[model samples]
Target: MTTDQPVRAAVAAPGGPRPPQDGPDRGRGGPDRPERDGPPAEGPPAEEARRGFLAKAFGVTALLSAAGSVLGLLRDLLLARYFGANQGTDAFLVAWTVPETAAPLLIEDAMAFLLVPAFSLALVLREERPTGPDPVRQLVRATLPWLMLVLAACSVIAVVGAPHLVRLLAPGLADPQLAVTCTRITAFTILPFGVAGYLTSALRAHHRYTAPAAIYVAYNLGILALLLTCHAVWGVRSAALGVAFGSLLMAGVLVVPFVRGLRATRRPRRPCGPAGDSLVLIPLAILPVAAFTLTRQAQVFVERYLGSGLPPGAISHLNYAAKVSQLAMTAAILIVLVTFPVVARALAAGDLTAARDRVEKDLGQATALVLMGTAFLMACAPSVVALLFERGAFGPHDTAVTAAVIRVYGLGLPAQALIGVMVRPYFSIRPVVRRADDPAATGRTTLLDWYPVGAMALGLLVTVAVGVAATPRLGALGLAAGNAAGITAAAALLMRGLLLRGIALRLPRVLGGQARLLAAGVGAAALGVPAAAVTADPLLSTLLGGTAVILAFAALGTALGAPEVRGPVLGLLRALCPPSPPAAEGKLPHGR
Candidate 1:
């Protein structure tokens, strides 16, 4: 018997080991796969093993995630120190759009959206029919080959058309040839990125977190090593080469684990005729998601395009600002990231209540984290930028402009996090149809909805319109304002769409909670601004401003009855200094 057989059997039903799949598909017996009508073969040992992993999963993932974010920030610092923000960095950044857009499409947004639900659905099917062909393996086998071919071809096209791509991205670039070279080099990231994304989706569905969570750490390390070692020789092109190398490391780290898991299926069952056709969701649903991702990323295109028409350093300044601002959105979304698979599983088991509850709680937690970040980041923008990038080639002027741009961009953190969290529900609780082979089978089929893409397109149009009207006046800050406005608009539209889709979110509660948080945010910002203004030193300003923001937000949030903020503060107080037995039942005379 293979090692995975027992675990697989137990996970065949809802509330079983490995975090449960569903009950409807459980009691299938076969020589290759066992029938698990009760507890897992190893029982409590199995329970303990899975429980231990879940307990440590979030903490471990958070630690690795922090390392990755810190390393990524360091990577940017090295770039500013070594290359500085100039026409050269702008040229590289125009090329940098390749990986920036590709990373989300391949690694985070599109691939995850398409594959996670597909994998979850496959696992459910596998539970239902033990004697049928292994659906998970079947899924990988069916899609991986075609995906490799398409991504490889796309990479080649990118290399051959680098000049045209650069021209389209930034028509008024000072150094078009430099951009072409970087584009050609970074284009190779497409293939490795696709592989890495696919592997991550499969692994996460199976409850393996370490390798996937550590991917960005590997990614950033690769970029830093190569850029540092080769910058003297290759100049800005080293950063482009670093992008390609880093993507390879991302794919490489996940391969061994993926292959090991796939091999655990052992022997495959004989033909289940036409069963493979049932897994059509992967091929069909990818379009709307991919379209959604591409349009969302087109925000970068708009920024660079507008910035291109301005001065030499405009694009570079915008890039630095965007990267720094997104850190808040990134940190806040990690909470949603870990919970997405659980929501998908819940939906797969036909448990909408559990999925809704999970989604609601996620919204609360995500809003709180992002709001706190937005407060601190906005209040301390100048100091934060000065402390991180003021030295090296990035002078006080660069710091000043970038700081302004980042604060303006910070206006969109709430909306961005909203989109990130809300999109999970759309992809998870898909509408299903009956399978061809089994008349009674309840399975999801691919249905493409263009509403998401349409919403993004509208948002992009607004961004461009606002950017044009303001670029001649406010410069990069205007562009940042346009972005914030556009995303806020998009976030509203998506919520409307979300309600129309019939996902019973308590709109009044959600909106009311957000209003309270916004009130707290205003108070935080009001106090935090002057706290920083009191000190000229960047480090001092950052510390004082950050502390003031946190304190004001908590105090105000508690007063306003915002659960996200109050819950955490009260919990910490309880942990540090518990209440002393009701003050000894009216005998609290010592202090009095």
Candidate 2:
């Protein structure tokens, strides 16, 4: 597929045609293979092709992500075995918050939110039989330098103020000096992470997905390797070093692909004037997004701050539980990453129908997937936690705490998935004015808007209030509850905003599917709990209980006609055992 084609159309069908393999712009082959040569495929062929491609892409990504997640789980297991939930672990977690918080702002979801739309818009404008210079290149040149400068400045601030920052984030810490040292080491990651995020945005804008998707795997592998090799020398601080080195490794993985993408799209420079003015809209767009990101990240701040005041290891418990809960969340996010760019590009081109269709489809499928995962996780929380992290310093007591927290967090998985899906539409809605006479209208509007900001702010307030009130009495469980509540409220507001903006969500169908999914989940839990009770070993219990839950959910879901279950099951079958091509009319079949 050519760069000028809409991203949706490019991946819309499978086995259609493949693009030239030798072009300067040719990206590394992975999940998103090029379409077939010749005219675009249409009708059922196109639809089936798209579905097959999506299935393959989703499968490949999920497999790789699951690998990374396993490594992440192993990292936690080792940490639990080696360090336990003590002052050192708590201190490392506290210091870890810098990257955790900054990630959303610099290179994770936040950057995706701003840059996807910006890059999509740039792509759209560049394709418009240009009257002057290339807007995409112009936007990149204008924003990248300043973005790097800001990232550098933040890193310096974080390094210099590490001690003060640690005090503010975890005032009750038992070892402030140790945390400060860890914080300083982690601080250096901000710069490299920013560079990685920028490169990721650029690649995604060009509709390249493989390299960006592999980033986390690369990062986790780096950390896992470093921790194993250097733990004896640096102790817990080795984790901090792993973080910094991993980030640089993450950035390094994308360099060649990003440069190739840049080279493919490179164009002659033109003087900045009306064409370049659209570049200013990027930062403007980033502001409200940045605010929304900060508010979302603040939820973490609230959790950690309140958790710090609780008994020692409260923060670590929360961290471990969150990792287990996030596995499902990560799956939902991978789906979003694939679909969001298509939605953004559609909206940028002013095709609301396409954008709306994509959003609704993504929302339903992602929601169903998360709900099923939540059921499995919540039903088998104890077994799951124990199987993954119940070795070494992590005993039954620690397992119990983490399991309880995971169950509470399971309540909010649907809301978290929905929030991720719902937020994309608002970002994808570009302001287009019909009056051609207006000189000020540069074919785009500022990126930051009130809808996302207001929705997120309201959510943040609820999270802080609930967290503050419940932490003293209920401890880490309270923090989990607060997070669930805040995210649910935010998801609701965002959904309502979409409705008000005239984006039809087909509410009745969506709600019906969800109700059925919930029923199936409940039914699954009913069977799974007993199956688990029959087993004495944690690993065996998890295997038995999880299998029972998944099978029940699948049977009930198919009986209830849930698309989420049937679609994937069928897709996987089709992918694994494809049909044979038709024989020639005059020729006998091979068997005959």
Candidate 3:
């Protein structure tokens, strides 16, 4: 089946993916059915319609992500004002690692990598054999229950071993007790994080994105509310309380839509796919994916580990800087989040060319987006930091430290975005057709294709080595540099691995395009800084710098003949100022 059909967002709508009207389980899509249950819409109109829907989805996601980030910004501001960048904040951030690590496994990386493809395959299977047990429901029942149990058990283990975690993660921390207390509170997030991730995977697989994207908004709102209400009594511990409570809200918001979607589908039969066939291939495939995630995230671990021995507020500075820098990467990554399922479905259909094109396009687009963001961020880091966090207990000294660290993190944003782009194809949806050699039965991608973990492991080791060498003299700056170096190395290796793993992405073109974008970004930053310096006010300086970077990035990109970067810029311009159609014979309609 051609994968370019209008990707109906109703995949999770109970009445969405229905069989023919006369077909069994006939009460198909309820009131919200987008199209009839038949062959898909085709031609240019269909294509345009598809683009419209995807654009809408992307917009909705961007809006929700921005909302969450705003709330998160407020939460960070509250912390900066109340807790300040001190030993207490450092200890609390150490506990924050609980939710951080859990996010990749349960919410973002491992779960989505494993399940989006699985759910996509299940949807395919259901479409193929409509009369049989619904594979979607079957997959959920077989995996979700056991998955929740494992996650809950992990949560309990984390709570029990909070002290051990604190010691291992940050041995030299001055306030280990506070860190331990915070870890114990945040440990409860494992269950909620797992469930939320699982639900997000399921929802996205069915073309449902609103609830998934709203999770962060819900999460940050929860944190902002709890932390504010409890700050006077709870002190720094309020941050941990917010994290735990917020995670619950993350999962809670998705429940109704998840169940509603489930109910709309047909009931399941006992025997689903083949005899003893499984929907989730977690037992085997998860090892490398999980390892890669852990290793990549270990940059933070390494920083805090080494930073613990530094001054009391060093870790806090790194965390604060990282928060600002990540916004650039996050905006770029939204492209991948929306298109990941398309790539998965393409691969599942055995359409390598389609998947290759999709992945390549997404990489270039995301790269351009992030490079521009980096230009703005690195150029305006000082002004941005002062404007956001210089009030209350946070002062000019803290702002200087955070600005320096954030620029280092900003330099790595493109690498982060690239890795996000590449990983989708690395774990593309496998074919559901089972093979005798397939023990996990997930599909073509397997343990032998475990290069990402090794690559990330190498990066983490590099991070550790670099941090150890530089942390003593440079302090948090050294740690920030280590993170940048490691991620850049990993991003390069992952690019080459795509070729080795038969992904068919043209590395020369991709690298060349990146080289051009890098030049454009540098130019953007170079000009943006001077433009920012023209203003004395922090907020005004940031605005000027940000505007200058966009103008420079776009102009320099087009001038350098980088169409991959140019295409998106032109599209945005047209969207803002569409031209009017010419009047026939030079006469305006109904005039004179």
Candidate 4:
């Protein structure tokens, strides 16, 4: 027993424990075990644990995102069950628009853009001289007081002006009651997100992003549960209450972790002046950031305005389609956010070569993924929509409308994805400009400050033009067309920025593979379109034919040299249909 204790100790170590003594190798579990000749068991796990900082950080972000997306899916499904594409649902959608838009602006997007890079630089600096002072603590201290003041002022303004904002949200609406109600409900969303924004930024800066992000997943799940219970008991008001509850819960969850992270890190040094004085300058910087956020909000409000003039269900249809497109976009560029801060820090340190290499690799992968998705969606639009969203209150008319919109959105899938890729690098570049400016002068470039503003402006114009031109004749297709055109223009502008900056994007030599993918997709579409066209029942034909086409395309892509097809294909095959016991190739080395 004493002799075996050493073996047990080795087994309990980090990697896969030692092979079982009870196995066929039981007789070989002697004192002079194979431990000397064989590799150490902990080696693999140790290597995995020794991942680069970004991988560890991003792994957490991805897991949280996946969880949040799942929760969101559940919430939407429940919402759909309770309220199909109808007037009440449309109103709820409009009301939620402010908070929904506010999320990217106030919480995820801005915090991610600003905080991650700052924190990354701090981490890198600490690495250079482990015992040296961290500049971030000072930055954070200076930034915090201003964050609170700005958020507080905004909260007050939002509550006071909720009424007018609602009217602005749906300007085309003739109903005064509808406009007023939307504003009131949406106002509650503003403060919670504002609070969540600051806290989450702090959390992410400390590299504790995963736990905080999970808070959002929890928030969504809570909303889903509350909405279901409330709708059954009290109806639509419950849904609104669910949104408010979720936001508050999100704020609380993020706050606790954020404060803990702050305490763990040393306070930033304030060498020159009073900390209070630095706080005053923080809001001045925040003002432009706030304007940047509000401008984005204004663009979404425009879309809501256009949507309101349509049939009662149109707004809901547009939202649902937009959601689907965004999910695909999210999956494609999920790595971008993770790498963003790393890139930012690299650029700030004047390691432009390293920054370019990282961005280029990430963009290449992103482009391939986006193009692949676009092909799939283009091939299987009708069926994909029918399969995912045809049940509950989503009937044939709803399916047809949503599918049309999704297909149009599909046309610009590559462009929309590249927008995320293009902008994040500029974010890194912006900081360089900020640092170079006179300490007393206005700190950032107007071009850097409002770059997204231009992209969004073009998108808004294209959307309006599409609505006007297409609504009269093509309906939902027109709306989608406008979106596609807008994203395409945005992509062009982004690429032009890259070119002007002399950032060359070397296209990956996946052309042959892509050509194969396109061919397979076309062949699958050829088979599916006729099957769908000939079927008397539109819904069944659409779903069945589309599935068949996608499967056929996937099979062909996999069998060929399509690298993109293999990953998802192998995953699904392994998951849904496991293999039977395999035949032994030969006797064991020692022989039976």
Local distance difference test, each candidate: 0.79, 0.76, 0.80, 0.60
The window of 10 residues in a row where model 1 has the poorest summed lDDT is 4-13
Name the regions of candidate 4 deviating beyond 4 angstroms.
1-59, 128-133, 174-179, 267-299, 379-392, 432-449, 501-504, 507-592
Cα lDDT of model 1 by residue, 2-60, tens digit: 32111111111112234454455442322112223221223566445433444455666
Instruction: Give the per-residue lDDT digits (tens) of candidate 3, residues 1-592.
Output: 2322111111121222444444443323222232222112246755555566567667877888888889898899999999999999999999999999999888888888888887777665565556556667767776788888999999999999999999999999998999999999999999999999999988877767788899999999888888889999999998899999999999999999899889988654433334433333335456677887888888988988899999889999999998888888776778888888777766765677878887888888888889888899888999999999999999999999999998888878898999998886786633222222245353234544688888888888888888889888999999999999899899988888777767898878877888898999999999999999998899899999999998999999988878876887789989999999776896667856
Instruction: Give all TM-scores, in the order shown.
Output: 0.87, 0.86, 0.90, 0.75
> Which has the greatest TM-score?
3
The prediction achieving the highest lDDT against the true structure is 3
**Which has the better TM-score: candidate 1, or candidate 3?**
3
Cα misplacement distance, residue 477 of candidate 3 (Å): 0.6
**lDDT sort, best first:** 3, 1, 2, 4
Greater-lDDT candidate between 1 and 4: 1
Q: Cα RMSD to native, each candidate?
A: 7.1, 6.9, 6.0, 12.1
In model 4, the worst 10-residue window by lDDT is 4-13
